[model samples]
Target: MFGIFIQHHVSKPNPPKKLLCNEGNLLSQIDGKGTVYTRVGGLSCNYDKGTLIISDKSNRVALNIE
Candidate 1:
């Protein structure tokens, strides 16, 4: 349920449902709804006290990348 902003327009409607990361040679994933995704960019996070922090400044759930 997301979309990418490109040329000042979103690529599609109701985007995908999952995201994956292969950073630091480690596997990380975020998923929802009925689809799955893997992308190189999404969130800026940090691991603290056994928890992964995505964003602390906004209440927005989905990411819109161009």
Candidate 2:
């Protein structure tokens, strides 16, 4: 599965969360407190190849290939 995961500013000791999907999707408006282990605003993904595209509030895209 492939997808991007973001951790928005939320209320400490935020546990790490992972999302895996066969298709691409977006998650937004997440509320939590500790340093975001991962923070993303947008993502593009292809699960079969384990490829992922992630972006931050600045809209910078990063690719993860596996």
lDDT of 1 by residue, 1-66 (tens): 233346336434454444332342212343465454454343555444544445434532333432
Count of clashing pairs, candidate 1: 2
Root-mean-square deviation of each candidate, in angstroms? Answer: 10.4, 12.8
TM-score of each candidate structure, all chains considered together? 0.27, 0.28
Model 1 misplacement above 4 A: 1-37, 56-66
TM-score of 1: 0.27
lDDT of 1: 0.40
Cand. 2 Cα-lDDT = 0.42
